[model samples]
Target chain A: MHPRRWTEFAIESLIRVLGLSSIGFVLLIFLFLLKEGLPAFLQVPPENLLGTRWYPTFDLFGTLPLILGSLLVTATAISIALPLGVATAVFVREVAPGWAREVLKPMIEVLAGIPSVVLGFFGMTVLAPLVRETLDAPTGLTAFTGGLVLAYMALPTIISVAEDALDAVPKSYRDAGLAMGATQWQTIWRVVVPAARSGILTAVMLGMGRAIGETMAVMMVTGNAARMPTTIDSLFRPVRTMTATIAAEMGEVARGSTHYHVLFGIGIILFVITFVLNLVAAGAIFKKRRRGGLR
Target chain B: MRPKIRVDHLSFYYGDKQALFDISMEIRERQITALIGPSGCGKSTFLRCLNRMNDTIPGTRLEGRVLLDGQDVYAPGTDVVDLRRRVGMVFQRPNPFPQSIFDNVAFGPRVLGLCRGRDELEEVVERSLRDVRLWDEVKDNLKQDALSLSLGQQQRLCIARVIAVQPEVILMDEPCSALDPIVTLGIEELMKRLREQYTIVIVTHNMQQAARVSDWTGFFWLGRLVEMGPTGDVFTRPQQKLTEDYITGRAG
Candidate 1:
């Protein structure tokens, strides 16, 4: 028996153990969420979750407002972030030259690396004031401010994802377009952008998922009123999202109470929204691969 | 007509490194001129110089005249777009856009605005695809993805794309390097057919290919034009010691 073969065996066993440990951790998180979330649903009746009003204090937790609020905030954030984020990504990857690329890349990295609390504070101080001043409102914290902050926070993800997507298109594609006598701008618009469509979709969906899952930054900005929004303009008003509801009420609501259980239910809603968004991202990636398949 | 191209004491520099020397050549109208040399002997660089494709690379400077039909291609007033449109190029790798087979053939015609109506455009595309002998195989599958084609088919598609534009001159940079022997022969035959209408210049490492396909052969050595003449003269008779050793397989 050679010592080299023993070394190979050891390395192989280590890789297997490491892979299983990762899977075990993901399984643990899924099981924990399922176990804690399932019982609360069983204890709380369907009318409590789906009925007209939302009042969970008397062993009846209606989840309508929280669900609506979460949808509103996530959709608003995505609407604002997508265009600006993708444009910045294109500028950084294509239009920006050497010194600009060097400067912009690290700045985006720092934006991504900043602590969420610090971002929340910045949102609290800067963005909220801007929104308040523009809207002529008393409260700086509103859904608009929260959405702005989340867009700012998710900017790095969108830019990096879209940049990687644009970069993955081979240089030959660009060269082919150029050699066809197409202008630079025309080539970028017609050939490069269309080729990167699925990739850009994935980036947008990933950013959407991230914005929806965001907690601290969004919580610090949105006014957290928990009212059912009437008009689209009211999106800028104080609104308590599901995550915000959980954060604001989970501690005060005692254990086994309907309010506490409903907060847990809000967690389930947030998890579901994020899960759907991620599934959309995965589907876009699959479609891109299918279209760009090896023949 | 005028000579299709003229190179006089043409030299090129890649950064501080010089790639082409005081090499001069002329491409007459409707002729297939083959450039042959060992690897890294500036043959490809000289071929690229014709269409100013080398302008894409930064820090590359050229001091020469690349006159297409006596019009200076290096002249500042010369529009690169118009020049490239008139002088199409095909790469060694057969790079077709990730598009439908029809779109790939239609790309150049669309860019040049060669046809106004859809029927005329389709007719041109069909004719171009037929010219390279790929229309019969791909006519039914025009809507299929270009990437779905095999390597040999893709190379032919690229050739079809160049002809679709109806360019006066075509530059082929080792077009058959990535294909099998049968495909290479097919392309060689296609080149024979294409030479009647388009002036073709190609770089090939295969000496036999140059001998078989080209009327004129230019031998490059260490960035210098060692010798150039009719393919028969270069292959049968020795003009220079280097050309003799190289063609005879004795020395590079």
Candidate 2:
């Protein structure tokens, strides 16, 4: 073989190894999580592991409240975010004039730059007090506060992604709709939005993932109350998410104690949930792009 | 034949760049008026101006008048939606909505509320498809995606979509440019049939096509209409040196 061929082969192999090593590291982390967290499932009884209460000090690690807390916060954030995000996207991409698009895009992107901790701090000081005063709740630090902050945090992702989706829809589609006597708004809703449906769905899923996986902001505002969310009114009440539970208690627990294992178990659960969500989003995006290619 | 549309001293501009020079023409009702020109000579621009499609582009301006049935279409209260419904357009490329075949044809009628209900809408779709000579092939697969059809079929679907609105005037901008020669002939045949009901304005780079399908032909050269006459006279007689040179393959 030529000497140049040998050099090329070596460089290609080196790059291939670099790419494969990242996957190897991910597998190693999953293995380590399983080793540390799987022990808690064996140590604690099944009922306690799946119970409603989460008093770790009382030897109770029922994750139901924590799971519900996360779900309620994430769901609330999504409900608040989806419509606003998609609307903002449409406004920015389709309705806004050129100068407005230039100003609004950067401003929305700037929201993504604010630190999560700063958002949490803002939630604690500004939003929590406002919520307490306005709704006359006992405390301002509640799941609703967390959700509001998370919704703000997730807006940039949803808006930018949905904007990109709308932008990707061919100009010809708009022309066809317009030439067919449809009004601009009607054309955008009936034709352009449907054409970009898959991309918009991907945007919503990604926004949901961002809301669900967020920890610091949620931990700061949710009041860290590990209680069962029994009623619709509990959305404004204090609650603790699985991520918050792990973040707040991980440092204090003994290294080899069952408490430490339980925190790791929560981490594993978070990992699995996010992993599944990301996978589903990826599959949906791939399918949509493939269908778009047929056009 | 009666004059269906009249353009007087029309000039178009995209921002500061002028696209169409001052031009005047009369499109006859139930007749095919073909505008033949080289690429970027403003034939399509002039076609779009007929129905105000250029309004969608920001910073574009038009001077002078385009009258449809003696009504100034560019008047302040002209109601553009109604103007578009009356003067529907077909593009150079087949741009079928990514929807079912039936939905694609029914889009215009449904949006305009021209049909009263589902069966009426179905009737319009079938009639429009039949007019385009595509109903026999597409009727069985009306629920399938429009993008699933061949390019030739998609163009026919687009024509059907435009016809479904029952427009008085049809503007086709190089409508056969994307199809094979055989499919092009089929579209030409369909255009001839359609002209009996709707006044047709077509922009084509193919000069032979202008001679073949059009009753009247306007030769455009660099944003200006150089000559206008019956297609036979334009093809056989030497009027302007430029028009004669173009028809003889000596000039663009």
Each model's DockQ score:
0.44, 0.66
For candidate 2, lDDT tens digit of each residue in A190-218? 89988888788888888989898899999
> Cα deviation of A37 in candidate 2 (Å)?
1.8
Q: Report the number of the highest-DockQ candidate.
A: 2
Q: What is the interface RMSD of each candidate, in Å?
A: 1.7, 1.3
Model 1 over residues A1-295: C-alpha lDDT tens digits? 6999999999999999999999999998878767667777877788767754666555546677767777787778888889888888889877888689889988886788878778889989998898889888888888888888788777888888888888777777777776666666666776677677777888888788778878788788888776777677668788767777787777787776656666776677778878887887787778657876422
On the 0 to 100 scale, the lDDT of residue B58 in model 2 is 96
How many pairs of residues collide in model 2?
0
Q: Model-by-model lDDT, in order?
A: 0.83, 0.92
| Off by more than 4 A, model 1 | A1-22, A58-64, A136-140, A290-295, B110-121
How many residue pairs clash in model 1? 0
Q: How do the predictions measure up, each by TM-score?
A: 0.89, 0.95
